[model samples]
Target: MREGKRLGRVIWAPVGAAVLSGLVIGAAARLLMRGIALAVGGLTGMSLAGTVGILVVFVVLALPAAVTATARPVIMHAGRWVTAALTGLMAARTGVSDAKIIVLADDGQLTPITVLIVAFAAIVVLHGRLAQYLTRRLRTLPESPAEVLPTPDARPV
Candidate 1:
């Protein structure tokens, strides 16, 4: 009922933040890289459409881990920022490299950026699952019994 809805919100909120952060990171990275590419020459590996596609893919790749990681309150509130930043960096770097590799492949200069992306995505997904598992285990663990301490009175002394 209300608890379920509250739990849902807690889980979903970080996911929303991840989506937002992904979009922002992707757009910013694209803009910065585009500027650098243009400055070097008439070079631009990824088009606007490619940037959009990569951003979409990045969001998809990030969602699973984001969901699992958000299960913890501290992670949902604070750790999400760190996760977002790291994931964003990984996405941006991989996106740029992938685009460059695609351009190279077009000219018969093929490279394997897909493997890099796959590996990175796998790490993110696995890490999230591990965090969720650890949290669940901790929650299920029994607390140790407290020992009773006797107070000494003057008579006892």
Candidate 2:
């Protein structure tokens, strides 16, 4: 029973992280889509924004699954690729969103792909360690404490 419970805890950690990350990343992607829609200024822009935002959400959700599955040494190298992909997507999404603001400031147009490329380069070059931080943190969390109960003598009759 204890082992089963332990297995459940192990399973719950990754599942819970994935759900929470989904909600958070989903909101951020929505905001980015809104920014893209505003920047592109048409129905076509809304379509593109929706596509990119959905892709981002899907990519972010995949991170937790990747981390959970790659926890063992059998395919350890795959973990690095997963981390890199997640980080790159995060940076690209952020860059596109930031570019929207920059375009507004300059009163000019900018392509999302251009900003995505620049952000990917910048993040890989400057913040290489940011990848997997959240997933790693979740993976290392301590298990819950054991339960305690009162003895029969201590219980009310």
Q: Report, for every candidate in turn, its global Cα lDDT versus the true structure.
A: 0.51, 0.51
Model 2 stretches with alpha carbons more than 4 Å out: 43-60, 63-66, 69-77, 83-107, 111-136, 139-157
Worst 10 residues of 1 by lDDT: 106-115
Query: Candidate 2: lDDT over CA atoms?
Result: 0.51
Query: 1-157 in candidate 1: lDDT tens per residue?
Result: 8577556555555556446545654565456556444433436788778889856755554554455553567654344445545555665676676475355443222223344345445544443344344434443433333323443553374
Count clashes in each candidate, considering only residues at least 3 apart in sequence or on different chains: 0, 0
Each candidate: RMSD: 11.7, 7.5
Best model per TM-score: 2
Please give the TM-score that candidate 1 achieves against the real structure: 0.43
lDDT of 2 by residue, 31-108 (tens): 554555465563324456665665465445445443544366544345545545665576577666666555564336
